[model samples]
Target: MAAAQGIYTWDSRSSSYSEIYARVRSWWELLPDGSNPLFVLVREFEATGVTAGSFAVLAEQFSRRSGTAQAVRCDLELAKVQEYPAPWDGLHVCTVTVQVVDESNNSRNAYAAPVTVMINCPPAVTAPTGRCAMVGFYATAERIVY
Candidate 1:
């Protein structure tokens, strides 16, 4: 028989919505072209607390602490994307993009993704007030130019 196909609707009274979603995922996995993209629907309120940019920053920090020495070095350069030619004759060369978000959550976009955030920590009793921000970064290893 040719591949059979049918559509069925279930009443919520009979099965929980979670079960329906699980079934859909199982069917998706059986598709012939697994490469097809899967789009999921989630309520805005249902999303996790952090935004995508914040999540990228968190992952970058984790990688910095755990990744290879080159990874750490790359971040250092990324911190200053405008700078050129690998400080101290480094082995890898890279380009960086930075973004800035203001106190009111307004964002300043640059030609590339941001690598650092400027945040102000509490000052000493005699010191002045401060502000805070976040930036994103990514770098690819490049061959030595010289």
Candidate 2:
């Protein structure tokens, strides 16, 4: 599902596919109130600076898919944002944790390797010219420091 959503092009050797698959199944099981796993996958991709064929790949993750895709929802509260000094004097670091969780009350299912996004700011003032780059991304549990 992650590859289908353009969250990433599949890598046969990578463990991300398994992790994402599990997360998707968990979200699907939660059904009614759980956050949309696909939407979150796209957000995770964006956070990681994904490169694909076109915007359509990314756009399809949110809309333009099957009817059931419409039911997918994102939880804004799951993201926690923080600001800190970047390595340079003028640039600042903006970090966001896109936490993935299961609907179950059990804490064990609470966090599934959060998608960490780090952006280097400030964006340019002009349209068509402005861009903020993501300096860091930790896509899965192995990247997380215990």
Candidate 3:
């Protein structure tokens, strides 16, 4: 979907057959009303040319094929913009979550390896160039400690 939406995808692997598959199934429940928008539809894909292609390319193709694919339904709120305080005022907070039940695909109670997640959001982000660049002056004290 990132590729489809012209977003950045961090897919780096040898080219073989497409083995990367991703999906975002979400729902929203207003704190009070308990009503929110739905995904309308969601789907996961296993691309053939995925091995060599960047996630951007694969995601684009996946988005194109989103209509004719099977999707999974979810019961959690996603990307719900809630108001924050002061410095974070105008900027809304977008949150994504997942539930790992003892199901077939995601059933692992052990803690050896959790799960690597990929979130579906817009491409534009506040990415930092240097180490810990996204961190603000709050870390100045720690920096001085060094």
Candidate 4:
């Protein structure tokens, strides 16, 4: 069996953080047997006016045409937090990783249709109302096919 992979990038402006979606390629196949997995990695995350501990990353596999979520939702974990200078002063930069559950038992036709990885930012109780920015944001979806 060989593995098929798709790499998708976030194409919107950094200021738009409400609902960030990465479009997966239509040519990639989604295999059965629970082998298809999507990985989201954010190399640089910044929430202006929000503290490091005041925000969470929520990600889900969704189908826009159907207007339904296809896979289990996950909370991305921040690997590290660091302080920056000048323009980013008082803001914390973080690294995040999200792995969506395997896409299994779904119809091949359903999988063939357009799918997206949607990312959202929800503020914690102590967090102030602010905008979220993601840099180097991308997703990788892989499946093994015979």
Tens digits of per-residue lDDT, candidate 2, 27-145, equal 22221233233555444444433334433343343311111111122223223222222334323222223333222122222332233333333442211235444333345544421
- Model 1, 14-73: lDDT tens per residue? 334455334433433222333223442112101212233443543333311111111122
Candidate 2: worst-modelled 10 consecutive residues by lDDT: 63-72
Cα RMSDs, all models:
23.0, 15.5, 17.0, 18.0
Per-residue accuracy of model 4 over 10-91 as CA lDDT, tens digit each: 2122312333322322322232332233322322122111112322221122211122232322222222221222122322
For candidate 3, write residues 1-146 as lDDT tens digits.
12221111222233222322322221111122222223211111112112334445544443222111122221122221212221221212221111221112222221111111122222213322221111111111121111
Instruction: Give the Å error, residue 67, model 4.
Output: 18
Candidate 1: regions farther than 4 A off:
1-7, 30-34, 40-146
After the best TM-score superposition of candidate 1, give how far the Cα of residue 107 lies from its true spot, in angstroms. 48
Candidate number of the best TM-score:
2
Q: How well does candidate 1 match the true structure in TM-score terms?
A: 0.20
TM-score of each: 0.20, 0.26, 0.16, 0.20
Better of 1 and 2 by lDDT: 2
- Quote the positional error of residue 76 for candidate 3 in Å: 16
